[model samples]
Target: MITERKIDLTGLKCPMPIVQLAKLIKELDAGEEFTATADDPAFCLDVESWCNKTGHELIRLEDSNERLVAVIRKKISEVE
Candidate 1:
């Protein structure tokens, strides 16, 4: 079964949200998903770029209330 984790990054500044996201992604198994909520205005763009650069999938991104919410799926492990 696929697992989904939730992370709250509200009030965090630029980079911190992405930093926390990266840390959480590292701990997730391949194909697992995470939903992160942040108040940083840059989070929307940052997460998109991060996913593109890292091969992860940005499944959904939206603004709710005063927060930016993103759902990301962990990338499959690369063969060595």
Candidate 2:
């Protein structure tokens, strides 16, 4: 079964949101999904880049109400 998780980074600034995301990702198992929500304008770009660099799958990204949400699936190879 796939596990789902959530991390709220709203109101946080650059680097911190990404930093916290990195930490959260590290604790997840392969095939799990996590949604990270943030208010930082740069979160979308930063997270897209981060996911690309780290080999995570960017499942979906939603931008609305001055908030940014990224749903990511943990890559099987990256779980270690």
Candidate 3:
């Protein structure tokens, strides 16, 4: 079974949101998906770059209300 996780980092400044998101991603099992919300203007770019660099899949990312919402899927292997 797959479990969904959530990380809300709204109102946080740059880097903190991405830092926390990365930490949460590390704790998840392969195939697990998580939803993260952040209001930092740089979150969208930071997250996209991070995911691309780390191999995690960015399932969805969008702006809603005053926040940036992201849905990410953990990669099965770190080296893959």
Best by TM-score: 2
What is the per-residue lDDT of model 1 for residues 14-36, given as tens digits with 9 covering 90 to 100? 87888898888888999898899
lDDT of each: 0.88, 0.90, 0.88
Candidate 3 per-residue lDDT, tens place, 1-80, comes to 77778999988998788789778887899989999989888898988999998899999999877689999999988793
lDDT accuracy of residue 10 in candidate 2: 90
Candidate 2 structure, TM-score to reference: 0.91
Please provide TM-scores, in order, for all candidate models, with all chains considered together. Answer: 0.89, 0.91, 0.91
Ranking by TM-score: 2, 3, 1
- Best-to-worst order by lDDT is 2, 3, 1
Q: Which pairs clash inside model 1?
A: none
Residue lDDT tens for model 2, 2-80: 6568999998998899899889988999878999999999998999999989999999999998899999998988444
What global local distance difference test value does model 2 have?
0.90
Better of 1 and 2 by TM-score: 2
Candidate with the greatest lDDT versus the true structure: 2
Off by over 4 Å in 3: none
Q: When superposed on Cα atoms, how far off is each prediction in RMSD?
A: 1.6, 1.9, 1.3
